[model samples]
Target: MKNVYITRVSKFLPNKPVANDTMEDRLGEINGKTSKGRRIVLRQNKIKTRYYAIDEEGNITHNNAQLTKEAVEGLCDESFSKHDIELLSCGTGSPDQILPSHAAMVHGFLQNGNVEINSPSGACCSGMNALKYAYMAVKSNQVNNAVCTGSERASSWMQSSIFEDEVQHLKTIEENPILAFNKDFLRWMLSDGAGAFLLENEPKGTTPLKIEWMEGYSYAHEIEACMYAGGDKLENGFLKPWSEYNSDQWSKQSLFAIKQDVKLLGKNILSKGVESLKNALEKHNLNAQDIDYYLPHISSYYFKENLYDEMKDNDIEIPWDNWFMNLSEVGNVGAGSIYLMLEELVNSGQLKKGDKILLSVPESARFSYAIALLTVH
Candidate 1:
């Protein structure tokens, strides 16, 4: 197999960075009342600033496809252009529409000539899966180069107007669900952004990141969904998808809104994740000390200490200095989280030849995870 190197990394974050106190203004109050859990969520997540694709009036300024298109365009220059790309792969948790694939919409905005396109669907791992697809395409000589992207327009889903009907439905039953619930918790936790990576058989810079190996796993068979949208988690642990519910039920239940089972998340998010990492490390005969940089796509800072403890117990602890994170500033951009982290590090001018970077992303959607090892060449 041919070696694949990341030629470039680019990111696009829409509009201005919204501070913590101003989040309520951008997202608005659900049912015209303040969110009781917003402060708690922000405090635990430790997110100081986040971007949104909407204006103060809660009107959309950029959609998912547009954000991703701009990020891909940023990858172009005299050496490379959209027309030169042979494959396009895009991944996102939130898409502009349901009919067309996310990659199709991005391709429409790019108009970069006819090329093979792939869209990986799901939560965080979706983006890594897209990268793997591009990696394999170039590694197998199926394509000379590919553009892979991960992005989110979560502000579109966080709007208060989307939950009006569901709020009323809760009031009827005399139930008050706070923002930490399955309905509104993510509003303060997600930011708007897109990130792209250009992968080719040839290295681009003085120290280009090479794709050494990648490993992904899912524990869905042993666990229920931890985070989800376009569906409701039934008591028996079945996810009733959007198609199962009619139009009337959609608005009443907020079926399209993102939600997470907080209890399940707190329990399994870190434990299972570290287990998978240990397994991957064993398979590759690599140790934590071998890493020069550690990039993990954790949803919040709440897991930082716990993850460190878990890694230490599993004998997979990388030193604190080797870790890099931008979660507090960028928020959790779903599939784009790791891409954004890599983009910043790739441009930080800190990397040198022979450095090793470990990339890990654990999706709480259903306890799935992916880990990759990259080497600077």
Candidate 2:
């Protein structure tokens, strides 16, 4: 098999960074009432700043397609252009439209040539899935080069206006006006951004990261959906998709609003990740000590310490010094997080040939994980 190397990495964070204290001011409050869980979630997330596609005046600045286009454009250089992109793979949890597909919209924005396109839709692991598609296409010699991205425009769905109908509907039914914690909790945590990587058969940069191996596992058979959107979770834990619900119920129930079963997430997330990580290492014949950098896409900093402790219990601890994270400064951009972290590290000029980087992405959407290994070349 041919080798695949990431030649360029780029990211686009829309508008300005919204501070912790001013998030509600940016996203707005539901029913003119501040969210009771806002402060608690912000404290646990430990995010100082995050980007949003909407302006302070709540104007549309960039949608998911535009954000992805901006990041993909960031890869253009004297050596490469959009015309040279043989394949495009894009992944996002929140797409601008459900009908035409996210990649089609991104390609329309690019207005590039007739390159083959793919869209892998999921939670955070969606980005890793996109990367795998590009990496495999290049490695298999099916394509000379590819551009892949993982991005999210969660602000669009999190805006208070999106939930206003549901709020009013609840009042009509004489139910609690306050949104459920499962619905409002993620509103405080997610951010808007896009990150792209250009993968090619040959390494281009002075320290291009070579794609080594990728592993993905889904525990959905063993567990129910822990995180979901565009659906409602039933008592039996089945996700009743938007298509099944009446069009009127869509707005009344806010079926499109992101929701999470926090109890299930907290109880099962870290342990599943740790075990999957251990298995991945064994499969690769690698040790934790071999990883020079450990980059993980953690939605909140609250899970960091707990995840580290769990890793230790599995006897697969990677030292804290080896860990690299940007969730604090950039917040959780969902799919784009790991790509952004990798971009920052690459731009940091801290790498040497042969340095190993382990990417740990856990998607609690259905208890799935994507673990990837890369080496500096």
Per-candidate TM equals 0.98, 0.98
Q: In candidate 2, residue 162 scores what lDDT?
A: 90
Deviating ranges (above 4 Å) for candidate 1? 175-180
Best by TM-score: 2
lDDT of 2 by residue, 1-377 (tens): 89999989999999888898889988899998999999999999899999999998889899999999999999998778888999999999999888698999999999988999999989899999999999999999999999999999999899999999989988987756899999999999999999999999988876799999999999999999999988999999888999998899999999898999999999999999998999999999999988999998898999999999999988899999999999988889888999999999999999999999999999989999999999999
Model 2 clash pairs? Answer: none
lDDT per residue (tens digit) for residues 1-377 in model 1:
89999989999999888999999998888877888888988999998998999887777899999999999999999878899999999988888888699999999999988999999999899899999999999999999999999999988888888888877877887777443366778877999999999999998765578999999999999999989999999999999999988889998888888998999999999999999999999999998999999999998899999999999998999999999999989989999999999999989999998999999999999999999999999
Against the reference, the lDDT scores of all candidates come to: 0.91, 0.93
- What TM-score does structure 1 among the candidates reach? 0.98
Model 1 steric clash pairs: none
